[model samples]
Target: MEMDEDPDTLPAQRQGNIIITKYEQGHRAGAAVDMGHEQINIGKYANHLGIMQETELPPIRALEVKQRRKESKRTNKWLKMFADWPKYRNTKKLSQRVYKGIPLAVRGQAWSRLLNIDKIKSQNPGKYKAMKEKGKRSSRIIHRIQLDVSSTLQNHMMFIQRFGVRQQELCDILVAYSAYNPVSIPGQRYSWAMYPYSAWVSPEGVSTS
Candidate 1:
């Protein structure tokens, strides 16, 4: 299913110190939504579990409203910056903004742009799919990866269920990476290495190439 044309306009709600954005689902149930050019089935989980919550410091009621307004203004500025990133990519202003902090709402997009994900994907077309297929055929380290995938981030709601969507994605990534780099045997630490990328870009956005 296609994703919302603009996730930026999605409704956001505050729970405790966490801000959760609600993404609309597609026509079909359990269909994956495109996020930053990657098919990730986060909409369902996000709606039910608030999976994409961004944490913030606890503030007083008035301060919380003030903070939200401040953040909203910053978010708008960042969005404008994203439209013409090349203009500010290496500027001191960009560095200053980064130093201040990237808004949680646009962090995923910001990370993808900063890391030049599109360029990497273009240079190595179909590599992820190829490695994933290779991973399915290869069996040397599958058992080890399976054992560690569940334990990597089990505390998080996204990975809490045994062999759930997120866990399977993690397993697929490790398997694909193992295939892509034959000499590297993925261990528990390898899962950790992939976690940060997956956290921001989703598993599909991770570049094994």
Candidate 2:
């Protein structure tokens, strides 16, 4: 079949320049051959401070992590046994286990027990709900946090779909936690509470965007 003549030279309206091509017609609706699409900014593409990046890896190193994870399963016995607080009160062993990194399956429970989250939760019933209520009332922080949370880890699988379940949960937790600890420098008065707030986007060190 015949192709259209050079679109630039063709007598057409300036705004409606049309160069019909097979690829453009079949796939992208408005990607006319003669249309000049502006190049996206280099900074936007390169400025991935918190975003994950692809990396080449040594097979041996990858295998070692995999092996460690497998061995971590054996430690589940100790992890479960530690739940009985009366029988096990060795802080050093607990610290060592934490340093080794608890298995993902029981990590949440282990952390809760280690941090005495249960005691705090029990002592302050509905405290988390109260913080969430406060967060909802604070429109300014909520708006800002919503915007930031929506963009956080935008390239990751969990966050790729904006406002997805995990993203919403992350946003809620952040907002609630901020309200729970409404202090810029938590350690200013406490002497040892100088912990800066930070978050890890993805467990895997790569963005599968």
Candidate 3:
């Protein structure tokens, strides 16, 4: 095939109408519909999992990563030594000392040869699909951390108070995690429900002594 042949014109790379995702080693419970046109299926997921609820999303700063991977404390000590290169370079001849302020261009072919972030992402759909398939068939309990994290009780409070929807949807996330990683919760502690205005009353007469 030619480089610009447009694989969307081909047959095998069509998109499907059904989309389902679930943790590996469990049952399929979450499904989504793709009612739009079936376009190119090169497998793009750059913004698929854009949900920002998790704070551990990887940083996107190149310089930050570079600074982090720098070897010595004195390595970037001269990072700002020639910071004003644009102002000085025109008046003075270019030299190796002003290399810190230089901006480099990234070549597409060079990127393809060096790192393959695209290929790794493109493979996720198949992996997620397979995980859903396996998870639906197997039996297990989800974990407590995921249960708390995915719960609608606190995070989805606005959604519940506004649209009155997604309570079950959020609960399902917790349920899935709870089922996948079940731990023993001893029946010793009692939980309570407090009204918003309950702080006004005094607990002086209600003694537990």
TM-score of each: 0.58, 0.52, 0.21
Candidate 2 error regions (>4 Å): 1-69, 183-209
2-116 in candidate 1: lDDT tens per residue?
A: 1224444222111200200111111233324222212334442343224433332233478767888999999999999989999988899988998999887777677778888
- Candidate 3 structure, TM-score to reference: 0.21
Cα misplacement distance, residue 128 of candidate 3 (Å): 0.8
Name the best candidate (by lDDT): 1
- lDDT of each residue in 83-127, candidate 3, tens digit only: 543453334333442343322121222223223434653755455
Give the RMSD in angstroms, all C-alphas superposed, for model 2.
17.2
Model 3 stretches astray by more than 4 angstroms: 1-117, 142-153, 156-209
**Any idea what lDDT model 3 has?**
0.28
Number of the candidate with higher TM-score, 1 or 2: 1
Q: Specify the highest-TM-score model's number.
A: 1
